[model samples]
Target: MIFPKILRLDKAILATGIMAVLTASAVGTAEPQLPALPQAVSSFGATVCDGYLYVYGGHAGKTHSYDTRSVLGSFHRLKLSAPERWEELPGGPIAQGLNLVSHKGKVYRVGGMQPRNAPGEAADNHSLAEAARFDPVKRQWEELPPLPAGRSSHDVVVARDLLVVVGGWQLRGRSHMPLWHESTLVADLKEQPWKWQAIPQPFRRRALAAAAIGQKVYVVGGLSPDGPEPRLDILDLARRQWSRGPDLPGKERAAFAPAACVLNGQLIVATNEGVLYRLLPEGKEWEKVGQASRKRQVARLLPWDEHAVLLLGGAGGGQNHDSLEIIPIPPRPEPTPEAR
Candidate 1:
C-alpha cells in the first residue's frame, strides 16, 4: 500500500495555527487540547461494551501468513477505569476475522471466514453465517440466528438499537464478489424473537467503516472494485434515505479497518495508518484530531468516564498487539452567560 507523503514542515506549521484558531473560536472560548494518545498493547478489531473494552480477532504470533491461517478467537476485556488489566471473556470454536459490534451490553460477532479444518477443503472455504453474541457479564457466548449470507471483511455498526451491516465479500478461488449488493441485514436486538430486516445499497462494498450521528449513519471509505477504496456514503435512519458525506481526506486503501465513536456529540474516526480525525456539522468535512504514536487499525474509541476516551486494539497487519491507549475527550466549552 502506498501512503501519501506527510505534509511539509512549513505547511504543517501553518495548518496548526489555522486549526488552533478555528477550533477554539468555533467550539466556544477556551482552547481545548486534544488528548494525548496513551500507551497501547498492539491488537485490533476490539469492541467496547458498557464500561469495558473487549478485544478479539486480528492476526496472532510472528508469522504474518499465520494470522489468516492460524488466528485465535480469544476475547479479552479491560476495565476503562481503575484496575487496567485484561480479563478473558470467552473463546469461540473457530477463529474469526475482524467484524464485531456491541448492543445493550452484549457483543455480536458477525460474519467472517475461518480456515477449513480438513485438507481437501480450500482455505477460502470458511464462510460463516453463524452469529455469536458474548454476554460480558456472564463471560459466555451464545449463538444467534445466522445471517442470510456467509461472508467476511464486512463492517457492522449499532445504531438506535439496530445492528446495521454493510459490505462483505465472498472468495471463489483467487477472485471474490460483492457481499453488499445481495442482501443487507438489520437486526433490532430489543425486539422479542429478534427480527432481521433486509436493506440494499446501490453498489457492493467490503472493508467499509461506519458510525452513527443522531439519525444519520455515515458509511466511510472501504475496499471496493478490488484496489484502494474511496467514497463515503450516509444513510439517514430517520428519513430512511441514503446520501453522501465528504470523501476521506487521505489516500485510498483497503484491508485497513476504521474505529468510530461519538465524542461530545461529534463523530470521531481513526484508521490503521495512525491518523485521527473528527467530523463536525460544517459541510461534513473531517478535521484531523491527532495521530497515534504507532500505526494501528480496527481500533475503537471508548468513553472513559465523561472526560476521556480509550483507543483499543492494534489491527491492520497480520499481528496481535496488546496495546491500550487513552485520550481525553475535552468537554465542550460553556457559553458565556448573558449579562443580567
Candidate 2:
C-alpha cells in the first residue's frame, strides 16, 4: 500500500470536497447527509442491500499493530433514506481482509483472516474458509459451504445467480508466509445445496476489487507478485472465458486495493489516487469521470442511488476513516444535434 503525495493530496481533497458540496447545492439535487460509521476501521467488509448499508469486521488497530482486540467482529447497518445511527446487529468472528456482497435481501460474508494470538504475542493470524449469510427476516446467520482453503484480502460479488470470490491469499500462520490464491471460486446462491467450484486464474493477487456488470465479473487492480498492477481481468460467466480489459489509469501503485461498483448499467472504479473512471459500455476502454473528494483505499464503493455513489470506510492520509463521501456521477453531455 504505497500512498504517495499524502500532504498535497489532503489539501487538494479538502478544497475539492467543499466545491462538490457547493456545486451539488447549486444544482438543486437533493443529497442526503451521509452518516459516519460508529468506529473507524480498515480492511473491513461492507455491502448495500435494500437501501441499507451493512458493515462488518475490520482492523481497528493501528497499521502494523495486530492483537486480539484489534480485529473486530462488530456488525452494523444504517438506513440510507434517513440519516441516523448505525444499528448494531449480530456479529460473527473477529475477521479482516474480506468483503461482503448482497443477494436478494440477504447479506453474505466470505473468507477472512483471524488472529489467534493475543497482544504482545507472536503473530498467529490464520485465514478462514467459512461462509455465511444473514437473513433479515430471521435476524440470524445461516452457515453455508466453506471454501476449499482459507482465503483473505479478497473481494466477492454476486453475478446473476452465482456468488464469485476474487483474488486473495491464504494466511497459514505466523511462521508461514501467506499463500496467494491462483484460482477463482464460484458458488450458486440459488442452488439447493451451495457448492463451491474452482477455476484456474492467470495470476495470484490480493487486495483487489470485483463487480459484475451483466454476466461478466470484472476483477480490478490490486497488489500482485510483481507489484501493484492495473490489469482488468474479465470473466464472462455466459461464455466461461477470461479476457483483459483496459488497465486502470496509472501504471504502478495506482490501484492497490481499489474499489469498484456498477452504476446506471455502467461500471465505475475508483483507484487509490482518487480518480474515478467509468468503463465504456463497449468494454474496450475507460474514461475518467470524476475524482474523489476523499482519496481512499480498501473502502467500499457503493451506488447510493441513481445519481451518485458513496465512498465509505477506507484508509487515507495514513489513517482509517469512518467518514462517508458522496461522489456524484457526472452526467454525460447531451449529444450534439448534428452528430445525432
Candidate 3:
C-alpha cells in the first residue's frame, strides 16, 4: 500500500521569500525611478553636519593665485529642505580650502594654506596647522591641538573615531615636497588630548583623497613633488601595510582635490576633470564611474545618509564653486543565510 505525501514550504524559506518580496516593494516605491545628474555647487570647502550644509574658507577665482595661497574665512550653511536661503554662522576659526570631517556631533577643519604676503607674489606660500572644532549644540568654536606639520593639499579622515591625516606636500622654494609622516593621529574628544600612532606609508605622496571603508583607508591619486602624474596607493589600517592600487585615469594635478566615498560596497573616486572611477575589492584596478559636471580642486566628499552623497566646492582651475552637487548612492546587496 502507498500513501500520498504532501510537502509544505519550510518556515525559514517562507520567511525569506516574504522578506524579499517586501524589500523589493519598499525599494520600488521609495527610490526615484531616475535621479537627475548632480551639478557642482560653486562653494568650496563645504561641510555637512546635523542635516545642514556648511561652506567655509575658500576664495573665488579672481582672488586665488597659482604661486601663492588663497583662503576665505566666511561660513555659510544651508538646509536641504530649504535650498534657497543660506544662513550665516558666526565666523571664527575659519579654514578655507581644507578638508572637514565630523565626529561626536562636532565638525573639525584641517589642512589648507593662506598667503602671508599680498596676492600675485608666488614667494610667500604657507600651509596652515590651526585645527578648529565647531560644537553645533553650543554654537561655539574651540581650538584643538594643532597638526605637527602644516599641510594644505593633504587628506584627513576619521576611522573608528580616530582622525588619520595622510600625505600632503609643503611649498618649498617654488616647488613642493612629497610628505609621508607615517604617523596616524587619534583625537580623543573625551580625553581632550591627541594620541599619535605610526602606520606604513603607501606612496609617500601628497594631495591625495582619503576614504575610510570599513577598517581600511584607501588613499587615491595625488601629485608628487617631481610631477603631477604618479601611481596610486592604499594603506591598510589593521596590519599597517601599504599596497599599490590603480593609477589615476588622467594627468596628475595637485591641489586639485579628489573626493572619495564608498558606494555599493565599492570605493568611488571622482577627480577634478569630472572623471568618476570605482575600485573593486579583490582587483587592484579602477574603472570609470561617471563624469563630473566640471573640474574642481580640493573638493570634499562625504556620505549623505544611506542613499546619497554630498559634494562640496573645490576650485575648478581658476573657478571656485558656490554650487552644490548631490549624487544618489547605490544600495549594496546582502548575503543569503546559507552563504553567511
lDDT of 3 by residue, 1-340 (tens): 2222212667787787775566456445333232211222332355567777766665553634533334456666666655666777766532344667777677877766655655666546566777878887787878878877776667777766777777765543346653444454445455557755556564555656877765567777766655564366666666777777677677766324577876544677778787776664554666664556666766766555555566666666566565556555445454111112
State TM-scores per candidate.
0.75, 0.89, 0.74
lDDT for 70 (candidate 2): 91
Clashes of 1: 14
Q: Estimate, for each residue in 38-153, the C-alpha lDDT of model 2 and write its tens digit.
A: 78888899998887899999988887677789999999999877877889999999999998899999999999989989998988999999999999778899999899999999
For lDDT, candidate 2 versus 3, the one ahead is 2
Better of 1 and 3 by TM-score: 1
Each model's lDDT: 0.61, 0.86, 0.60
User: Candidate 2: which stretches are off by over 4 Å?
Assistant: 1-28, 333-340
Task: Give the 10-residue window scoring lowest on summed lDDT in candidate 3.
Answer: 31-40
Best lDDT goes to which candidate?
A: 2
- What order do candidates take by TM-score, descending? 2, 1, 3
Residues 165-265, candidate 1, lDDT per residue (tens digit)? 77676543224543344555688888766767876675577666776665567777666665655567777665666777677778666225666666665
Which is the leading candidate under TM-score?
2
The whole-model C-alpha lDDT of candidate 2 against the native structure comes to: 0.86
